[model samples]
Target: MTDPITIQWTPKTGLPRRLTFEPLEKGYRRIEREWNGSEWRHCGSEHTTDLTLHPPEDPPTLEELISQIHGTWDHPNPAVLTFTNEDTVAEINGQLRYRSPTQDGWYAVTKTDLESHLRTAGYPTIHRLSETPYNRADFTADSIPRQ
Candidate 1:
């Protein structure tokens, strides 16, 4: 097996950031990040040992991982700017209306927006649920009842 992938970033200021990607059971991989700070503080995912891993195969590239860390993950939220697939720039009646779905009716978000809502929620890192390992039919009939 290959050694865990480690990425290091040194900003102009502040401590350096290091990310380590480790393989997990069931063909999954987990990522852990630490800030080169006093006592080597961890930046996110408090439960170090319990941190879930990402799948080993098809792991996100370094650029993708950096984007995610920089608050540009694919998930959408109103606080951050996000563009959806249906967004278009058009002059409607001469007034520019950047419109799309709003989180709380306060603002609009496009389908193609690329901002992270994690900061707004006060989280150092954002996590999203991966696709289920099995489909509903894969389970026994008695395992789950119809809603």
Candidate 2:
């Protein structure tokens, strides 16, 4: 069976709405939800015994994933903090010193930190994707620190 897909769009007269198609054992289920300015509210759902739907024949390549990520334009601008060996902490131009528990006044918050928090809060998956192009070495521990 194919993975669930959700398509979102905003109507000309109403709030934004999204339709999600989830694959089930018997068939598929379609769930409709609308954004009510605060949260998504379920509108309705329908099930059909359609098992002909399938995923793409070929899996998406790494290049395709990277290209799709760069094509998107709605990413948030996160605040980056830089940590020094001393107690003094300051925000970088854009935007850790790991000490004892008591000495830990402020440490740099990495992307891994935010992703871990979201996952712990019941989020399904958190991807460590970069806004700009990057290589494998960019994620290595010995790589240059991002500014």
Count of clashing residue pairs in every prediction: 11, 1
Best by lDDT: 2
Q: Who wins the TM-score comparison?
A: 2
Where does model 1 exceed 4 Å of error?
Answer: 27-32, 35-38, 46-147
Cα shift from native, residue 55, model 2 (Å) = 15
* TM, every model: 0.30, 0.33
Write candidate 2's Cα lDDT for 12-130 as tens digits.
Answer: 99999998889998778999999999999999997855434475475444334333334222344321111221111122322221111233133444335534533333221113223
TM-score of 1: 0.30
Q: What are the per-residue Cα lDDT tens digits for candidate 1 across 5-64?
A: 677887797677777756554342544455755654665532134333465576444335
Cα RMSDs, all models: 15.1, 17.1
lDDT of each: 0.34, 0.45
